[model samples]
Target: MTPQLLIFDVNETLLDLSPMKEGITKLLGNPNAYEDWFSILIQMAMVETLTDKYSDFGEIGAAALTMTSQKHSKSISEEDLKLTLHLIKELKPHPEVKEALEKLKSKGFRLVALTNGGRETLEQQMNYSGLESLFDGFYSVESVRKFKPHPDAYHHVLKKEKTSPEESMLVAAHAWDIAGAQQLGMQTAFIKRPGKFPYPKGKKPPLICKDFTELYMKLTVDA
Candidate 1:
């Protein structure tokens, strides 16, 4: 079924995360450190939610950076941590993002962004990418004090949009995010970004496209 609303995940889905590679590699002294840092950040966010503790996504990210640095026996100064987190606000859209969004919008699909980033960070990132005007609405998990993969986060968006789970589809790069949406009864599309894959044990997403362009085609042409 064609969805009435397409809710997108902000980080790594619409925005390219390559901007963070330099800061992570410089701080951790490993070219592959970016992946490790991101994984830890998500893990900690889940930890905070599961433990019934609330922390801003940015705070969890900073703590994750510190933990990753210490795990590697590297010392990351506070300034360095701040700089690395700041890079998130400077991310650019993936090459095909603008065109794909335009096509989807022109076709009358309501577009919204749902992110784990706090409201301020989400605004900054969207403004930086110059894609803020394209969305009908933006949502942050901060209000719910939970991260993606948590049922409430997904439910909050459905409630706000007045769209039922079956009428909305979630498009995300993270396997966990897709799984969460799937469990909540929303159709899901996984953007197979570099080094990203679906969770092996979860319900499979109905659509797994290579990128935004592919996703647009799949939804418009194939669906």
Candidate 2:
């Protein structure tokens, strides 16, 4: 079935985080600290949800970077931390993203972005990446003070759009985000970005594309 609404996960799913990875690695003085910091950031987001506590995604990211520095026995100044994280606002969409999204929108898909980032951060990202006009709606987990993989985060978009889970499809690079939407009965598409994979034990995505170009082909020319 063709979905009426296409909900996108902003970070690695649409916008490339490689720029941030480069900045973070340089800041931490370790080539691999970026991955460590990101893993901790995601883990801590879930930790906030499970504990019924909320923090802005930006704050969590800063804290996660701190934790990574501590683990590596490196001292990071606050100024450098903020500067490194600021790269997120300057990220570019993956090379083929803009063109593919344009094609999808031409097909009458109701495109939207759902991110774990805070509203301000989401705005900065979209605006800087030149994708703000592409989406019909922009959503952040901050609206409900919950993170993705939490049912409420996915439900927020559904309720706002008056669309059923089955009538929507979530496109993401993260296995956990796909799993969250899957549990709610939404159609799922996994954009297999480099260094990203679906969970072995989770529900499989109905569509898996190498990039948004392939995704556009599958959802349109090949549908």
Candidate 3:
């Protein structure tokens, strides 16, 4: 089926977060802190899903921060935690992200954001990127309190978009996100950005391109 809609993974896909790696290392302790924090965040998010609990993304963020800090015998002020979350909302988009989304939107596919961020943070990030106006709607895992890799997160997006998995495309830079979406029967497109991954969880994306510009060419969008 021709795709009528495209749902984007928000974090590493649209935003460039290489800076955060440094920020967290200095602030938290380990250079690999982002990965550690992110892993725990996902674990907690999934825990919420497994136990039928739902919390805002911000709450999950705070809990994850507290847990990680406590485990490492480090300290993080509440203000610093707020600042870190704010950084996410204020992140800059990837250099090519806006142009890519513009090209995709002009081709008549409805664009939506599917993220693990809270709705408010997602909105702020979108507006900061100046790509907010291009998106038709935003959906987040906050709706289901589950992080990526959980089928419910992807399923929630599919249901809200009112399209079958086959009729929609999931475009992401994270292989795990791609995997989860694919498991929900959604067609996927991978944008192979540096530091991103592409190994599939179940099958794989039907198309993988170096960037959205190449993706546009494959879709044959008239310039």
Candidate 4:
């Protein structure tokens, strides 16, 4: 099938969150706390998705941070929490992101975003990257108040594009996002950026790439 829609996942996938990770680690009084905190944050997001609850990503993030600090017996003030949240709002996109996005757009695929980020947060990220207009439309899980792997986030993008799952390709660096989209029968483009790996236990993606440029080259044929 030739996919007409291309959906992307923000954060670690497209938008680099390393700066936020560094800041968080420093705030937590441990150099690797950010890594542990991110793992816990993702786990909690899925818990919200599976158990049927609604909370913004930021709130969940704060909870995860608090848990991490507690486990490590570290103390952080409210000011530190505020600063961490602010840093998330200012993450930058990877170097190859802009050009790859442009190429995908020029190839005639309708680009869209399916983010766990709230709407305002997505706007901030896109605007900061100076590539906000590259997409045909944008969306956030804020509407459902549930994060990815729940299928709602992917379905949201499909509905907005008015394209069937088979006709839309989901591109993401995270295997969880790819797995979530694939569960809905959507074609998947796994961008194996650096240390990322395949979904632990779910329908695996159909295609894989080292970066967006690799995915872009293979996009000519679509699915």
Candidate 5:
């Protein structure tokens, strides 16, 4: 069934992270450093949720960068770290993102963003990408003090929107996010961005498209 509400994941899904990747590559002199750092950042965020500790996503990112730098026998000054983190707010949407979002909106789906980033950061990201007006609402996991892949985050969005799990579909590039939403009985669409793959052990999403354009087609024409 087609969903009444379409929940989207930001960061690497809708917004491209290549700019941030370039910054990390310049800083660490390794083209792969950005992927390593991002992986660690997600791990650390889940650590906080599991340990019952709370830290803003930005703080966790900084800490992860520090740890990653230390692991590579490099030291990142506070000023440099802060500057790099600021690049997140300046991310641009993927090439097809705006058009696909417009297509979805024109079809009358209620679009919302549910991210692990803080409210202010998400706001900046949406505005910078010029997609802020496309969404009906923006939500952050900060409200529940938990990150994505946690059941609470998905439940909170469902409750706030007053939409049942079956009536909503989550669109994300990450396997973990899709798995979490699946556990809550929500439909899911996975966008296969470059180098990203779904977890082998998780339930496969019903819709797996190459990009936002393909996803839009699958949802609108094929569904």
Candidate 6:
């Protein structure tokens, strides 16, 4: 069935993260710095969720960056870390994002963004991307003090929107996010952005697209 609500994963899915990746790699003087830090950030976020604890996503990112630097035998100042990470708030949308979003909105689909980032940062990122006006709402997992892939995170959106799992679909580039929503019985779309892949062990997403334009095409037909 076609979904009534379309939930988007902001970072890396709608907005491109390559700029921030470049900044992070340059800061740490290591080509693998961004990937390493992101891996740690996700792991620590899950650690918080599993332990019934809460911490700001930005704080986790900073801590992860520090750990990555240390692992590389490099020392980074707090000032530099913050500066480099701030790049996240200035990301640009993927080339096809704006047009696709507009098309989806015109088709009367409720669009919302759900991210693990802090609320203030999520707002800044959206506004800065010039795609802010296209969404019906912007949500941060901060409200529930949990990160994505945790049922509470997804539930927060569904509860706030008053949309049922079966009536809503999650569109994201991350396999873990797709798996989480799929397990909850929500419709799922796996965005196959470059360097991202589907989870082989998870249930297959009903829609897998190379970008938002493709997603718009498939969703239009489905609707």
Query: Which portions of model 5 show Cα errors greater than 4 Å?
Result: none
- Point out where model 3 deviates above 4 Å: 221-223
The count of backbone overlaps in candidate 4 is: 0
- Separately for all candidates shown, the number of backbone clashes (residues 3 or more apart, or on different chains) is 0, 0, 0, 0, 0, 0
Which pairs clash in model 1?
Answer: none
Candidate 6 lDDT tens digits, 102-131? 999999999999999999999999999998
Count clashing pairs, candidate 2: 0
Per-prediction TM-score, please? 0.97, 0.98, 0.87, 0.94, 0.98, 0.98
Per-residue lDDT of model 3, residues 124-173, tens digit only: 88888788899999998878767777898888878887889899988898
lDDT of 5 by residue, 17-110 (tens): 9999999888777887898899999999999999998899999999888887887777778888899989999999999999999999999899
Error of 1 at 109 (Å): 0.3
Ranking by lDDT: 2, 5, 6, 1, 4, 3
Question: How many times do residue backbones clash in model 3?
Answer: 0
For each candidate, what is the lDDT? Answer: 0.92, 0.93, 0.80, 0.84, 0.93, 0.93
Q: How does candidate 5 score on lDDT?
A: 0.93
Error of 6 at 157 (Å): 1.0
Candidate 2 residue-wise lDDT at 65: 93
The model with the greater lDDT, 1 or 5, is 5
Cα error, residue 58 of model 5, in Å, equals 0.2
Candidate 2 yields a Cα-based lDDT of: 0.93
